[model samples]
Target: MSIVAVLNTKGGVGKTTTALNLAVGRALQGRNVLAVDADRQGSLLAALSNRGEREPCIAVAQYVEGQALRQQVLRAAALYDDIVIDAGGRDNTALRAALLLADKVIIPFLPRSFDIWSLDDMSALLVEARAIKHVDAYALLTMSDARGTDNEAAGQAVPDDMQLLPTTVGRRKAFADAGGAGLSVLELPAHRDSKAMAETQALLAAIFN
Candidate 1:
């Protein structure tokens, strides 16, 4: 089994959005995927509940403390083919706990100066994480402007110590719409092959391949 954590030290960088979409996308591909919500905000699980969706199709579990989080993730690894964690947007215990268990970590950042600035802080965290575990980490631009070159510029600014993913998710209404309906951009009836879906698929491929 493979375990991945979707994280960023800064909030509102689309951590939950990335976690949910990745979980659903993998499940659609016939994987036994389990999404773990390690955030106290419970944003990951809330997204599905708010839209009245439930599983067997996509299993979810919430555990916030470091000990419990690590224990649960380790146990679930034996049963699920894939595990995706939505870590809290802070350098807190939950995030640390996840880093200990994850095989790879995906950090999402918005394409703004302030967001790019936070990458320094996130870099420090990743450094500490890598020192203790053999975890592969990458940063992906999320909620990027579709019309401007800001995303490209931001990608260049990312620290060389941190890996930056080529695939980026633009600021599209389809993301919010699909999240509201408790579906992934790929799971949406129409726009199944739209830019949003393509971006999501690219991220999944980058992470899983």
Candidate 2:
């Protein structure tokens, strides 16, 4: 089984969104997925709770404490094909615990100054995480402008240790709209934005393939 953690030390970086979508996307591909909400806010839990009945079902659990999070993930590892953890927006015990067990880490950041600055702390955390175990980590640019050099600049700014994903998710209404309704871009209806679906699919392919 693969355990993936979507994390960032800054808020509003789309960690929860990435986790949610990745879980649902994998489930759609016939993999049993467990999505863990390690954030105190419980947004991931709430989102999965409200998902449409017709959408692919993703098992979810909320564990905020460090040891609880780690223990639960280990016990459930064999039950599910994939586990996606939303590790909140800070460097805390829960986040640290996730780093200890996750096989892959996906860090999402907006193409902006504050987000770029936060990567320094994330790099240090990854350094600490690596000392104990090996984790494949990748940086992704989210909410990127469709027309600008910001994406390129932000990609260049990513720490050398963390490879930047080639696929960038643009700032789109489809994500917000689908998310509000507890749905992924891939699950949206006839009027859904094709670009949004395409971007999300590309992201999943980059990570899982």
Candidate 3:
């Protein structure tokens, strides 16, 4: 019965990747999961198809556009144990509605300067989401390389007011290939015991545990 919205005002920051994998990752762990494709771009939907899901993924746009029955939205989603909304990279009505419904709002960003710089914008959006739903949001650092001491040090330098995930995804090709297959990084055998999976699992654990 928990709603998690994956957001970042800045696109290409692994927001969709996080949303896609985290949903599948949770489901693979035996928790029922529903992935809501809220972005009109249909990136999630395209990725879902690549993953070869038998069930129709519920696209919020379709619900809003009258292509699908709205009453069936939550009911269809409820068939799963967890619901994830891929909110794209902007602030809009759909994103707002997802925020109001979310129990946790997870924002993922890279370790670069622009990625770090974009935090303020997302934080403001999180504030707006909180103003509507009264829920706190957290940020997760993605695509990090420990060997790149600078990125590692940057994460350690985060202020107390900000939250940086303890586990980080090192530079790995598995992520890109896995996404192409509609599979999560966790779903990749090589990543099962990798740091990326550990970090992702830790994030999921924080939410469900």
Q: Which candidate is the best by TM-score?
A: 2
Return the TM-score for each candidate structure. Answer: 0.94, 0.97, 0.80
lDDT by residue for model 2 over 33-95, one digit each (tens)?
999999999989998888847557878899999999999999999999999999958889999
Model 3 / residue 190 / CA error / Å:
3.8
lDDT of model 3 at position 178: 73
Model 1: per-residue Cα lDDT at residue 181: 62
Residue 61 alpha-carbon offset, candidate 2, angstroms: 0.3
Q: List the global CA lDDT of all models.
A: 0.86, 0.90, 0.68
Q: Give per-residue CA lDDT, model 3, range 91-178, as digits (tens).
A: 6666666666677777777878877777787666666766655765767777776564767666765444447766555566677777
lDDT tens per residue, model 1, 63-110: 989899998888878899999999967888999988878888888999
RMSD of each: 1.6, 1.0, 3.8
Error of 2 at 42 (Å): 0.5
The number of the candidate with the highest lDDT is: 2
Candidates ranked, most accurate by lDDT first = 2, 1, 3
Candidate 3 has its poorest 10 consecutive residues by lDDT at 58-67
Whose lDDT is higher: candidate 1's or candidate 2's? Answer: 2
List the candidate 1 regions with Cα displacement exceeding 4 Å. 50-56
